[model samples]
Target chain A: MQDQVRSNVVEILTQAIPSLESKDSFALAALSDRAIELAAVFHDEDALGIALVTYAFGKLVSRGGEEKPLAPMILLLQTAVNALSSDDNSAYKKSIQRLTRHIQMVDNKINLYFQEILEKARIKKGSKLFESGFSIAAVASLLGISQWELARYVGNTTVQETQPLHTLSVGKRLKIARGLFT
Target chain B: MKTLVFDSGPIISLTGNNLLWILEPLRDAFHGTFLIPRSVYYEIVEHPLVMKRFKFEAYQVRQQLEIGVLTLIDDAKVAKLGDELLLLANNIFSSRGQPLRICQRGEMEALAVSILKNASAVVMDERITRTVVEQPASLQKILRHRFHNAISMNATAAQKIVTTCKNISIIRSVELATIAYERGLLDKYLSRKSSAEERSSLLDSVLWAVKLHGAAVSEDEINEILRIEK
Candidate 1:
């Protein structure tokens, strides 16, 4: 992993541990935001993994899932943080996987919930990347989301309205198009 | 021959709005080729063909391809130019030290084909691609606003892309809808008692349909077109 990504991951994990302990759903929200920022900048799977797990944690906390089920996941997060601090890349990867699987194993309902959150997160981040000037096709490809979904999401946003008009007026463009057709 | 290269945005917008049919009449009238890069073909047709939700729309676009309303262009030269263009475009803007990737192969390939074919224009509905080519300064402003960070521009790269694409004109699916209306192709929707108000309403509906379907056109632009048509 890149140094910037590594440090950011460590910081997020460190912050997230306390929040998860207190069941501070709002802190999870902030952690998710930071994770998303990291994901957006790096456009890497690791950052995206961080984002997904953090977001899922936030959702789970807000839903008031049983505390016992999540306790092990906190240990996994700590292990991940320690592995990163020790520059143990393989261990860090394993910890992240174990953390995700722990969440999945909590319950079938939680698994389904995680799946839904994953999909929604992909679309939401994909739209943000599109607004960041990435092409719709590129963002869709990057996020493994469908162009159809991205297009629909983008259409509802004000990104288009905020852009400056094309250098040519609508009439001039229409005239040019008309001339071509003729 | 006159030509128009299409990006995936306009294709998605048109197909979503069921306005893909307009391309046939418009192409017949233009007496020119409508080209889509192979990458774009995959984006609008091949990739979506397997997805259950969008399979029918993919088939509709594929039918247009089979009927020759849209032609697929694949050339190593276009691909090379496209990659080069993509690198330049993505590198033009950066937040902090990391260069922002703004354009992708599908969009850039369409642009490459246009630059090589000397097409009359590129029909695209993505604001960023259009803005990058037409006005990078405004694009920088947009990036700063969107990212809420210190966005920097590489003048050399921006100048190169702007100079490279200076001759390429861009229009949206919204414009295509308007063109269809102006050419009387959309008159089929008119009632027997069609009046000026009815025509205006028809134009309004068409524009809004494209807008709602993903054409990068604003309501103000639609109203301006309506006033111009009146």
Candidate 2:
């Protein structure tokens, strides 16, 4: 079952990307997908990762004159849906919150993509309308945004600020520096 | 879909830089798993000082092959990785019965684990990674004979990945990028961007970041910092 899906995704992406993008652009998607898939089987996050890679890839690709379909984009979009509306993944709703900023980050040039993400993030049944702690910085970085631009568009008031635990002591810091594991 | 193998380096870089969030896409991109070697797990979780931050007793990185933290590891498979690692790093690293090669044993085990686990690629952030050093003798042979390799990264690739990663995380925004600099995430970059007097202010900011991101001074933040110098 997974094999069929994998082959199908590769085939579709290969054919469709070429049709919509330049050779280099399509190749980037193809290569990235290939890498993501290999990473996927190693762990299980490949599909969603592909969706996300697609999300980010699409934005980058589009900017490079590549066009993407709303159909396939839905897969990555739906992962967020599953997070919000699905019952099986209830406990993981918090993790699902990640979709909010990613959606905001991607589809930046495209309004529809933003809407899709906002809907999922906002509509989780019974979820409080607020996770006031979500950081725009965290979101922006995850989405491959440039800090210079982020500082401008994301305001301090509307954009949540320095809320998450952000400290590491000297002792812990040195351990990372002493990366030598002998 | 390029396959990326996880070694402690990328994970640490990502985690430190607040790029761990990419694990979301990464986990999703890979269909929800993060693969690593079992020996690697012992290495990551067993550190005495490491306990100060990532409490292994509590958090298991949830992935397809949850080796140590949240998921179960396939022991037989892990041992298989250990075996293959022995071959990959044979001269320098011996898995069994060598007191001097303990670290090599650990590293080889990671490589083998990556291969046996069907990983598309193996990754490591060790100081002596695939680049910036001569290839391991055996791997040199493999690159020569197998693998039709256009996948190598040069500085451009590094910059691209870094830039792309930063954008995805929204850390690349001017405000955040500046904030990152202020926080010492991009120390040298911040310093260079500043006037000579601003350098002092920037250094002061670094001290602030030492306080701000204490345990959280992730690699992305660091990258933002280094970009200043670059």
DockQ of each: 0.61, 0.01
Q: Candidate 1 chain B — worst ten consecutive residues by lDDT sum?
A: B138-147
Indicate the residue-level lDDT of A68 in model 2. 46
Runs with alpha carbons beyond 4 Å of true place in candidate 1: A23-26, A163-167
Taken over the whole model, the C-alpha lDDT of each candidate is 0.85, 0.35
Q: Per-residue alpha-carbon lDDT of model 2 for B1-230, expressed as tens digits?
A: 22334554344333333434434433343443445555555544444224554553213343323432123344776676456434333223211222111123344444554454554444343322221112222222222222232222233423432332221110111222233334354444453456756665554444333323211233344444444433
Model 2 chain A lowest lDDT segment of ten: A125-134
What would the per-residue lDDT of candidate 1 be over residues B90-188, giving only the tens digit for each residue? 889998799887778888888899999999999988777787888877777777876779999999999999999889988888888888999998898
What value of lDDT does candidate 1 attain over all alpha carbons? Answer: 0.85
